[model samples]
Target: MTTIDKAPTVQSQRAGTGTRGTRILGTLTIVSMVWLIAFGLGFSPADRDQQEAVRIMYVHVPTIWIAYLAFVVTAVASGFYLFKKSLGWDRLAGASAEVGTVFVALTLIVGALWGRLTWGVFWQWDARLTTTALLFVTYVGYLAVRRLGGTHEQRARRSAVIGLLAVLLIPLVHWSVRLWRSLHQEATVLDPDGDIDMDGLMLFSLFVGVIAFTLFYVWLMLHRTRVMAMEDMMEDRGLDEALASRRREAAMPDSEEN
Candidate 1:
């Protein structure tokens, strides 16, 4: 196609394809989540030690991973928005941060539930738990900064700074088991050479859980970005209408003078 002919047509075609692709991915995500829950219920081997309680790890771990993914998106997108002044990047950063906070909350809840079973306590002041709690608080602070900022530029800069700083604490949380030798057990699957030590089916189900949760995150981010865009468009339309009304009012007096 000639360049002039391709412009609008190609753009619309790409938009249509992209929309379809997103819808398919979202459907797949829901299916995967359902499949994971079914597989975990039917196939995951009972933990010899913790018995059924260990099953929650599949949900808890994947949720925390989603939180990590969200923050990474937020930091990178915020940087791009600041440098390029792209609303696309800004909306991405905002969407990711909002979803990330929700995942963080879920992680804490599932973790506490898991702890109640395995640790014999609902919560603890130990190094690992404390550090994770601090990590949550830091993200909350980041969200607060974003909400309180005076302008888009101010929010983007402040949120990006906080996100970059908060990531330093994630490793601290992960390593707290070794750094302080607290009651928290060393990570079983993620530790170097630790081997999953889980049954093959259980591992498979958890893998599915991870995929499901990641897709869920993507879905939430997409929805959030679209909502933000609609809000922005509405605000712009409102402003334009107000300006047009003012101009009409101003012109009417001038017409009378003429």
Candidate 2:
């Protein structure tokens, strides 16, 4: 009797997608988050006008900043995927969009909570809020387009186009307050005159939030892209095995009747 030896599968060879660099980044993110919470919720002084409601800025501002950054990355990666026809770029774009969508949703939720406290309303059709909602919906659609039934290249091509077009809304959302009348205040940190209209401690805490969220975003991207790569590998392997099985069955000889 002959014995067959089976090779190890991709999953069997690896435990997870994490790496040393990602582990370090994850650690840094956790530390920064702890610091941000301490300062944002405990140390930072309340606004004379907005009072305790201003504390929400730490989370609200950082979330939108990360969301914008993620969307911009998705657009850039999508362009590269279109030009180079590389699956790596496509995976990056998809992962970025997914992360951006989560941040945008968080931004909306936090913004609404802040609004309820400051404006005594949970929602309004203000320019900034409306445009932001549009931005969120647009990226959600982009993510959906990525999952449409088709070949990988086909999906990537369509998604890349949407990713590029969707990012154009970001500028409009950011400047919506200046572009039209709105209940939302103009930029306090990113003022056009390069002046920051925030208390020193509040500003510091906001910056800390930005750094922490950015690190978290990088960590998520690293793991998400690796998972995407593994999924692609498994899919290709399955197809190849199926084809080989069909070929072996076709090559078998028929038995003769007695």
Name the best candidate (by lDDT). 2
- Score each candidate by Cα lDDT: 0.71, 0.80
RMSD of 2: 7.7
Q: What is the per-residue lDDT of model 1 for residues 1-258, given as tens digits with 9 covering 90 to 100?
A: 021111123124443213554688899998998898887777788877778886887898888889878988888877776678766677677778888888888988888887788777677655655665766787788878778846556666777667666767677666864466545445432221123677788788889999999988877766677666655555557688789889999877867667
Q: Work out candidate 1's RMSD over C-alphas.
A: 7.0
| Most accurate candidate by TM-score | 2
> What are the C-alpha RMSDs, in order, of all predicted structures?
7.0, 7.7
Q: For residues 1-258, what per-residue lDDT tens digits would candidate 2 score against the true structure?
A: 001111235547656777677799999999999999999999999887778878888888888999989988899999998899987788889999999999999999988888888777788666667777888888989999999967778888999998888767667666864466545554432211122576788889989999999999999988888777777666768888789878887787563332
Model 1 local distance difference test score = 0.71
